[model samples]
Target: MPSADLLLTDTHIRTLDPAQPEVTALAVAGGRIVAVGDTDDLVRDWQGPGTERIDLAGAHVLPGLVDSHSHPVWGLEMATGVDLSGVVDLDGLRGALRTADRLGGWVVGWGLDHNAFEGRPIHRELIEDVLGGAPAFLRLYDGHSALVSGAALDAARITGPRSFDQRAEVVCDGEGRPTGYLVEHAAMDLVYEVAPRASDQDRRAGLVELLSTMAATGLTGAHVMDGSGLDLLAAVEEGADLPLRLTVSPWCMPGVDRAGLDELVALQKLGGRRWRVGGVKFFMDGTVEGGTAWLEHADCHGQGTDAFWPDPAAYSEAVRHLHAAGVRTATHAIGDAAVRHALDTIEALGESGRGAHRIEHIESVPDDTIPRFAALGVAASMQPPHTAYTKGDHSDEWSKRLGDARAARAWRTRDLRDAGAVLALGSDWPIAHYDARKVLAMARVPEGAAGPAQGLTGLEALEGVTSHAAIAAGQAAEGGRIAVGLRADLTVLGLDPVTAPADEVAEAPVVLTVTDGRITHRGA
Candidate 1:
C-alpha cells in the first residue's frame, strides 16, 4: 500500500460512523481517509518517510464543519464599504454615513438595519445631507433592498417609478417620486448598475481572505448560494487551491426562458478540483421586515400578501423543468405562504422531488408545514444566527410585522427536528456573522432572540453543521463523517463540542483544521 500523505494521532476522534464511533488515530492518502486504529499501530503501518504526522495531544476531532448556506464570493459586493450594523437610529445612521468610506466617488455602505429608520418612511433626504452630495448606496441588512441618495437615483437614470419582472418596487411618494427606498433585487439593481464595484483583482484577494478567515473558524466547506463569481473562482483554483470546498448554485429568477434554463443545466457540468456549480437558487418572496414576505395573511401593515414572482406558476414550471433534468434546487422562502408554495411545488414533483429540494430561511411557518419536510424528504436549510435580528419581546420590526401569533414561531429548528425533518444549519454570512462556532452555539441555546423556542441538543447542533449539512448538499456519501474511505476533512478543537457548554462551544479554541488531507488552519 502507498504511504499516507498525512496522519493525525493522539486525538479523540468522533467519527459519527456507527461502525467506528470513536478512534485514537486516522491516516490520509490521496486526500481520502486510508485507515483508523490504535495510534501506535497506524503510525507503524502507514507512516513513511514522506508522511506528515501530527500529535493533537488529546484534542477532540470531528468531521470538518460545512456551512450549508453562505455567499462568500457574492458577499464581497454586499458587504462593501462601511458597516452600519451597529447603528441604532436615524441619528446614528446619519453619523455612520458622515464618517463612511467612499468607493469610487460613492459613499457606499451596507448592513443598514430597517430598525434604524425608526418607523419613518425611507427617503434620500434622510441621509442626503450627510453624504455631501455624493451618490450613495446603502444596503439594508436583509440584502433584498437598498436606500440610495437622490444623486444615486440620478446616476442610475431612475426617474419616478418603473416596472420590474419581479415584485420589486421603486417605493414612491404621493407625487410618484422615488423615495430612494428600493424594495427587492430588481429595484435595487437600478442603482447597483452604476454603483462602484470592486475590481476582479480586489475581489479575488478578498475572497481568499474571507474563506481563510472562515477556515480559521473551523469551516471546511460552504454551500455558496450565488454563482456570480464562478469565473473568478475558476481563476483562483487554477492559480492556487481554495482554502475550503464550495458548491456553487446559480439563480433561476422569475423571467428565465427555456433557453435560460438550458444554460443553467449546462452550467452544472462546470467544476474544478475543489469547487463545482451544482444547484439552482430561486426567490419565492423577499423579507419580512421589507414588507415583501409572502404571508398566508397580510402582515400588520397589510403588505405581506404578494410573492416575489409576478406569476407564481412560472416558478413551479421552472422547478419542474429543473427536476426532470435531475438537477437539485434551493429556494429562498422566508414566509409561511412562500414556504407553503415552495413545498407545494416540490410536492407536485411526486416522490422523485423528495430529498432533491431545499427551502432556505424557513423563518416562520405553521405547525402543518413542519411535518411536510420529512414526509416529502425536503431539507430545511435554516440560519440560527438570524434570530439575532429579532427581539424576544416581539418589539422588533420582524415580530411586529408578523404580529404575535406568527412571530412567536420564529426559526422552529427544534420543532422541525422533532418532526423528523432533514435540518441543515448555517450562518447567512454578511447577513449574520459566519462563525461556525456561533452557529453551533445559537442552535443549542438561542440566547434571547428566539422567544422561548426550544433549542437543539448539543449532539443535534453538531449534526446540523456536520452530517445534516452534507445531506442538504446531497453529498452525504462523499463527505460528512470521519469514516475510512471518506474525504480527509476534519476539525480539531480544544474540547468536545457535543458535551461542552454552549458559551464555551462558541468560544472554543480551534486547535487545527484539515481539508482534503491538507492542513488549512493551525491555531496557537
Candidate 2:
C-alpha cells in the first residue's frame, strides 16, 4: 500500500524486529523503511515508479552494526606514529623503533599493551636508549598509559611527573624521581599536552580517512568514547559526506574549574543532528592491564590499591548534577572497585536518573555487583578482546593479581546478561582491532583462549554488539533493526552471520552500508 522509493530483496533478513521476526525482503521509501516481507509483497505493495531495487542474492542483511566505544583518532594516528602492537619482544620493539622516523619531529609510538611486554619493567633509561633525545612518546595498549623521555617531557613543559598528568597519575619512584610510565588518563593527556596538536586540516583529513576505514570494516555507527574537537572530526566528515552517525561522549577535565563541566557540556551540544551527546565520560578507575585500573588488591609496586571509588561523595554529587541537567554519565570502571564505585555513584543520583549511565569495561567486577548493574538498569558496556588477549600467556599476572575467584568474574558478559544487565559490546578500537564482526566474535569465540566452552553464540554476541549497543547509545528506536518505518541504516554482508563460521563471520566482507536511504559505502 505504501509507495516505496526502493526495494531491497532476496536476502535472509534478521530484522532484529521481534514483531515480524524474519523477512525475506526489505522495502525503502524516501530513505526510510516502507515494508519488509516476501519479495512479492515488498515489490507489489511498496515498490514505486523509478524505485531502485537491490537484489541481495540470498546474502545476509541487517541493521548496520553500531560500535559502542572507540578512540577513532588514536587508532589511525598510530598508522602515522610508531606502531608497536605487532612487536614480539624487546628486539622486535627495538627493530620497529629503529625504523620509525619522525619526518623531522619527535617520534611517537602507540599500541603497546603492558601485558605484551616481557620480564623487564618499562624504564626511562630504556626509552632513552631507544629514542635518546629525539623527544619520543609511547602510548600503552589501552591508550590509557604511556612512556616518555625527559626530552619529550621537557618539550611538553612537564617539569615534573605532575605536569604531564591530568586525571591519571604519572609514575614516580623513590627519591621523587619520575618514571617513563604514565598511567590511564595520565597517558592520554601527555600526548595532547606536549605532542603537537593536529591542524584543522590535518584533523579533517584524519577523520575522513578514519571514517572510510570504519566503513570498510562495516561500522555504520560509532561512539567517540574520547573527548571532542570539531577540528578533529572534520576529516571524518569529509570522508563520510553522507553525515556519519556518531555520538560524542566528552571527558571530564579539571582545568575548567567550577563551570568547566557546564561549559564543556554546552560545547559538546554542538555535535549537530548527525552526532548526539551520548553521555559525559568520567574515569572511576583506570585500565585493567595498566595497573592504574583500581583493583581490590595492591599493584606490583604496592602503590596502595590501583582502584578506588575516588571521593564517593564528590563522584555521587557530580552524577546528581549531570542527571539533574539531563546529561547521561558514562564512567570508565575496569576493576571491581571502580565498577562498584560507579554503581554506587549512579545509585546515589536517585530516581532523577534521566540517562542510561554506563560503566565502560566492567572487566574485573565483583560477583555480587552483577545483579546491582541490572537492578539499577546500568549497562555494562564491554570489549571482548580483553578475554581473548588474556587467554594467552599475558594472563598470568592478571590471574595472580585477581586470583581464580575474581579472575573468573573477568568480562562475564553472559553473566551480566543473565543477571538482567544490558550488555553492549565493542572493540574499544586502538586497544583491540577486531572489527564490528570481531567484537561479535568475542561473544561467540572461546573464552580465555581455552576453547569453545567459554565462547558465546553468534546471535548472543551479535545482539550485544548490535541491538544492545544501540540501546546503550539511546538510538535503539532506529539504529539496531531492519524493518518498515525504521531508518535505512543497514549493512549488507557477503555471508549470513546467523550461520556463518565464527572466523568467517568476522572476516565477512560488507557488500554495502546504507545510511539515510543513500548508499554511503559499497564494495567494489
Candidate 3:
C-alpha cells in the first residue's frame, strides 16, 4: 500500500517471526516492512511505478545481522598505525617494529600479542633497540594495556607510578623505575595524550570507510560498546547517511560521583537518525592476559585478584544509579570473580534490573554462574572469535595464566544458551576481526584454539546474532525478525546460514544488505 519503497522477490526469507516462519517476498515502506507472502501475490498487490524491486534469484535472506559488541567508530583510532596482529614471537615483533612506519615522528603499532614475549615480562628493554630512540607505542591485543619504548616513556614524561580513579598501573621495576608497561586505560592514556592523533576530518573519514567495510560483510547494525565518537557520528550523518545503524553505550568508569552520573544520564539525549546513546558501558575488570582479570583465585602469575574499579562498592552504586534512571548497562567481566560481583550487583537491584543489565566477556565462569544468567534475566554478551587468542594445548598466555581448570570453561556459549540465557554474540572488533560470518562460524565450531569449549548449533548461532541480539539491546519488539511492521533491515546470502556448514557459512557470499529500507551493499 502507499507505493512500497522497496520490494524483494524470488528469495527464501527466514522470518524469525514464529507466525510466519517462511515467506517468498517482502515489501518495505518508510523504513518498515509493509507486507510478506507469496512472491506473485505480494508483488502484484504492492508493486507500483515508484517501487524499487529486486529479484534475489533464490538467495537466502534473514534478519539483518547485528554485531552485539563492536567499536567501529572508536576502532578507527585504536586500529591505526602498523598492524602487528600477524607477528607471532618477540623476534617477529622486533622485525615489525624495525620496519613500522612512523606517524607524526612516532612509531605506532596495534594488535600486539602478549604471547610474542614468550613468558618474558612486557618491558621496553625488549624492543627499545628496534625503535632506534624514536618514541614507540604498541597496543597489546587485549586493548587493556600497552608497551611503550623507553623513548616513549620519556616523551610522555611518565617517570613513575601514579594514582588513577580506576584500577590502572604504570608498571615499574623493583628498583622503582618505570618499566614502560602501562596497565588499563589510565596508564595508557598518559602516553596516548602526548601521542600524535588523526585530525577530526581524518577520523570522520576513517569511520565512514570502516563502517562501509563492515557493511560489505553483511552487518546492518552494531551495538557499539564505547561512546567516544558521538560527535563524529552526528557529523557524518549531517553530510550523508551512515552505512549501518549504531546503538552506542557511553562508558561509566570508577570514581564517578553524582555529577558524573548526571552527565552520563544527560548523554542519553544525544543521537542522530541512525545512531543513539541507549545505554552505559562499565568495566568490572581488565583482561586476563594483562594479569588483572579479577579472578577468584590468583592466576599462575599471582595477578587478577583486583577489579577495574578501585572500590567495588562504587561500581555497584553507579549501576544502581543508572538502573534507577531506567538505563540499561553492560559490564566487562572476564574472570569468575568479576562475573560474580557484577551479578551480585544486579541481584541486589531486584526485579527491575532483571533484564535491564548484561555481562560482557564472560570468558571463564564457574558452573554455578551459568544458570544465574537466565534466572536473573541477564544477557550473556560474548565474543567467540576471542578464543583465537588462546591455544588448545594450554600453551597460549591466556590459557597458561588460568591453569587447566579455569581455561577449560572458556567462552561457554552453548552452556549459557542451554541454561536459557539470552546469548548475544559479536566480534569485539579491534580485539578480533569484525566479520559477522566469523562470529557465526566460530560459534558453531570450536576450533583448536577454543580448548574443548562447547560450540552452538547453526540455528542457535543464528539466533545469537539476531533474536538474542535484539533481546540484549531491549529492542525485541521492533527488530531481529522479518515481519510486517518490523524495521526493514535484511541480509541476503548465497547460502542458508542455519543449514550450511560452519566453514561455508564463514565465507558465504553477501548478496545484498539493506538497512532502514535502503540498500547499502549489493554484490555482482
lDDT of each: 0.92, 0.71, 0.92
Model 3 regions more than 4 Å off: 448-453
Model 2 ranges with Cα > 4 A deviation: 1-3, 74-79, 163-167, 187-191, 234-243, 254-258, 264-268, 304-310, 352-355, 392-397, 446-454
Number of backbone-clashing residue pairs for each candidate, in the order shown: 0, 9, 0
- Better structure of 1 and 2 per lDDT: 1
**Predicted candidate 2 versus true structure: per-residue lDDT over 369-428, tens digit per residue:** 899987887888988876766654335555544556666666777777778777888888
| Residue pairs that clash (backbone atoms under 3 angstroms), model 1 | none
- Structural similarity to truth (TM-score) of each candidate: 0.99, 0.91, 0.99
Q: Evaluate model 3: give its TM-score.
A: 0.99
Using TM-score as the measure, what is the rank order of every candidate, best first? 3, 1, 2
Candidate 3 positional error at 32, Å: 0.5
State candidate 1's TM-score.
0.99
Point out the worst 10-residue segment of candidate 2 by lDDT. Answer: 303-312
Tens-place lDDT digits, model 1, residues 1-524: 67899988988998888898899999999999989978999999999999999998869999999999999987989999999899889999999899887889999989988989888877888898899999999999999989999999999998899998999999999999889999998899989989989888998899999999999999999999988899999989878889999999999998999999999999999999889998999999999999999999999999989998889999999999999998999999999999999999999999899789999999899999999999999999999888888889888888899999988888999999999999999998889989999999999877434644659998888899999999999999988898888999899999999999989999999988889989999999
